[model samples]
Target: MKSLFKIIIITVIFTSINSCKYYNFTGAKPIDADTFQVNYFQNNADLIEPGIERIFTLELQDIIQNQTSLNLVPQGGDLLYEGEIVDYRITPMTATADQRAAQNRLSITVLVRFSNKNKEEDDFEKRFSHFHDYPANEQMIGARLTAGLDEIYARITQDIFTESVAKW
Candidate 1:
């Protein structure tokens, strides 16, 4: 009876492991894709921030690479991501007693076009946006700008990853 119980537990463990071959904790479902490419994301926003295009492009590439097993390719990858920074805007979010701005929000929007060579049906074009809020008294430059950009990029890139591969 003890031997039978051990065998049952071992079989169950093996079955659970084997059944999760296609399951990724990150929720990425790249399926048949083995490689991906992120093209230069040009900054087409009306309020252009210098070097943001390069930074945003790298962020997208890094997120996909870090979360998935897909290799990065220069071209002709199984998955392709190309897009532009469509909007970068700062707006006053809250006002003080005197009607002065008390808080501000920095928002960034990216238009992405994802193509899956292995699965045409998975292709999509969408816009992902995110924002960071900070005190209105602080100028959006140097460390403040970097922090806001970092937060915004992290969210937008993750959303792109989810839409393009997570399939959740």
Candidate 2:
């Protein structure tokens, strides 16, 4: 009798926990979306950041795959995401008094399109971008610039994922 009572109590607790649902934290009601598709982002710009296309594609994929319970599909997914890297530039933001060198800022912009097949939501077309600054004195500017661009891409991808998956 005692063992049976303990089992019943445990089952009740587990059932209550699983049944509880909230609109916050997870944000929005649990969507029925189960599959997603992401296309390669084209780079049709004069100024190019090497590997920018690959970075954006994979980061966007990673964010959606990790954040939500969405299965990534090659074709005919419940949700579709596609976009392009519209701009990539490295410009001197500031110069030292000597004018020899100073600081540089690297910025990138990506235009994203999101669509849900069954829902009548906005189906947003959004541009997400990020920039990073570094002193000219830093050695191996090429490597640092690459790293900076990667960080920016990560941030931009995160923003996109938060909006599309988290519904925030």
Candidate 3:
């Protein structure tokens, strides 16, 4: 009885392994890009931060590496992503009907144009926006605004990843 149980277990294990589904991902489809090239995202807007370009480059590289099987190469990729920061602004949001400023909102927007070099098609082209709210702080408001911008950048990066790597 014990030997029969052992045989059954071995058979089950081998069957499961053999029946594992395999996915054939060729670069022919619009969503199945084998390689990607990310250019340095520039800030063309009047409002600029010192390290925004670097932040975007690093974030994009990290996302592509983690999310997809696509090869991250320095040049000559199947897909190309290039864009710029189009807008950055801050506005006050009112909590009361009287329009008294209760919080400040920092917003950032980026325009991404993605293309499949191998298939000769535009994969995605759109603008992504992200924002953050900070309560009114009289002291060091600039610092708060900068922190808000950082948060906005992080959100923007995530959106870009979802569109590019996640293929959504």
Query: What residue pairs clash in candidate 3, if any at all?
Result: none
lDDT of 3 at 103: 80
Per-residue lDDT for 23-68 in model 3, tens only? 2132121355678888888988777767767777777777666656
Which segments of model 1 are wrong by more than 4 Å?
none
Task: Report clashes for each candidate as comma-separated counts.
Answer: 0, 0, 0
Ranking by lDDT: 1, 2, 3
> Per-prediction TM-score, please?
0.95, 0.80, 0.71
Q: Residue-wise lDDT of candidate 1 within 1-168, one digit each (tens)?
A: 999999999999998888667677788753788999999999999998999999999999999989989999999999999989999999999999999999999999999999999899999999999999999999999999999999999999988988888877
Q: What C-alpha lDDT values do all the predictions have?
A: 0.93, 0.80, 0.72
Question: Of the candidates numbered 1 and 3, which has the greater lDDT value?
Answer: 1
C-alpha lDDT of candidate 1 relative to the true structure: 0.93
- Model 3 reaches what TM-score against the true structure? 0.71
Q: Please, what are the lDDT tens digits per residue for candidate 2 over residues 58-143?
A: 88888777766679999998888998999887778788888856888778888999998878484889999899888877742578
Shift of residue 141 alpha carbon in model 3, Å? 7.3
